[model samples]
Target: MQWQNVAINKMIEEAILEADKKGTKVVSLGLMNQGEELNIYGGLYVSRHPKLKVKIVDGSSLVVALVLNTIPKGTTQVLLRGKLNKVAYAIAFKLCQQGIKVATMHEDDYVKLKKSFNSSEANLVVALNFTQTVWLVGEGLTEEEEMKAPKGTLFIPYSQFPPKKYRKDCSYHYTPSMVAPNSVENLHSCEDWLPRRVMSAWRIAGIVHSLEAWNEHECGYTMHNIDMVWNATLQHGFQPLNLPNHTVIT
Candidate 1:
């Protein structure tokens, strides 16, 4: 993985430059391209090419929007477990602001998230009870952890991929995504693990970004208005999907 870093970065840089040359308005970064460790979600390219015309979007805001909205209605509390990212942080903060309690399974994560809160010590608390049936899951979730969850627990993933189906009793949700509208023609193939006509939130974010003609670059740690992006996506006919937990749904 480390060996391919330089080559991949070079390829990405070249592609960005090529997009600029062709007058492409925006280029959206996919899941792995975020490069949380190597680059700050495509910030390296922006830093290297200050005058680059093509805007870059990591699609974090839209992803956050999808995750937040996809959360089961009436959920007052949720278990947040996974490797924390920009979107995770944003989701936690927004959840706190909305008065929804976010319980962290790890002490390190709890302390870090608490420090992120700054002054007000509210919402984020230790996970003593897996009483909450809904778990906001992401990468680094293991089979052992899945086993700890109560029976019939819904593991809703907010990442690029879904969790392994280790527990037959516990349901694993499809990655946060939206169903493409009937107007979307020429979509013969399904995207990744999503069902037919369902598009990843990342790709749909770019579509909304272009539709809105947003001038600001959405790359790096910068976040656009989550509600605004969600509303615009809906206005453009992108429908929120009832994510599949048991199996893929067409």
Candidate 2:
């Protein structure tokens, strides 16, 4: 929706009012609602509004935090396929800090990355800039030629909608450890306000936001440092993989 559209803005304003009525102090805007191009920081508008009575935050920062925490330690060769947006850059920076070798390519070059690195060498593959047109079907493996990761390879793909259908043939088929949930229902109910991906982002954002709020008052210091925020959020539980039944090559 157009950011300046009076109807959409009014709807957001109304949602803020409703949240305030319920004594909610923090409000999170997810997905398109918080896009920089459309809204130019819509969360800031709600936060600065005198009548809103809520702290507003866009959850992208938290998503970055989760991705960092999800990556396994001692992982050396990492392939990042996505636009080098702020989120992608943040992930790269964090990985560098951890002494991991990182390679990044635009979405169009994904096939090249696939041909170049297999699970035997690449420790992890993260697909951040995914659109409907781009997905995670393996390069050559298909329904008839099922392949498994050469043990220890990890794949993490972000989806704004329901995840695409799983391909049993693909290497590294398991979900990321940090974002996994026991079931889809645990992620969100049908009545939830946002789609699953957006909801997940908002949920993770709330985790860090709550910590920052507490640290400010209790520690007399702000937790704006991403590293500290990451460590703090790690105390919260991250679910393990819920993979489909398939042979995982070791």
Candidate 3:
């Protein structure tokens, strides 16, 4: 009955996994409303290795940890479900500490994001002017610039606040043809091809084997989906047109 929410959550999780495989660090971020709701969504954080442990905490603690980039020695990641502003600041501060590059977005867009998240009116102005960060979520869609969020700003996509269905003609611009529909049909074994658009690096071993069996007559399907450049990363990598880190809030 509530399949949409499931799909959305799966999308975000898949993105994190795919991004992680590509060696891109991700961190989950969000703002918890009175009912503990998130506005910006979340992401995965990368560290020095694959099997690193992470810390999960309330929004405030996340901010402190991210701002300092000081997790306990065994921690490699952080997950937060809290206020949008605080989480954003933590992400920005931590990125700065690690010397990681970020992306920038248009100014008007930033203003709108601040207002939507109910961020401090005064701080909104200062944050907009002082930071060049990308507003990751907006109106059930992610800003294009979020793909490479800049330093000093939040990167949660608008879609994270109220997860929306993708449209073929209007709000979103992707076409079915953009994704190999036949390839999708052939991936029935996975029972969830839609998530692959964003989460490409994950192998889904058993499902992949099934796909291989189904395509035994053909020889190049894997290469088509694995070697070619799809969005920003290789076919086997996560390059979602919508920033992969954006959460699909429930």
lDDT of each: 0.84, 0.45, 0.29
Each candidate's clash count = 0, 0, 23
Model 3 residue 235 CA deviation (Å) reads 10
Q: Is candidate 2 or candidate 3 better by lDDT?
A: 2
Highest lDDT against the true fold, candidate: 1
Worst 10 residues of 2 by lDDT: 214-223
lDDT of 3: 0.29
Q: Pick the candidate with the highest TM-score.
A: 1
Encode model 2's per-residue lDDT on 95-207: one tens digit a residue: 65566655543444444443433423242343342221212221222332122222333455432332333443333433222342333244543214232432265455555
Clashing residue pairs for model 2: none
- Using lDDT as the measure, name the better of candidate 1 and candidate 2: 1
Least well predicted 10-residue stretch by lDDT in candidate 1? 241-250
Model 3 lDDT-worst window of ten: 215-224
RMSD of each candidate relative to the true structure: 2.3, 9.3, 16.7
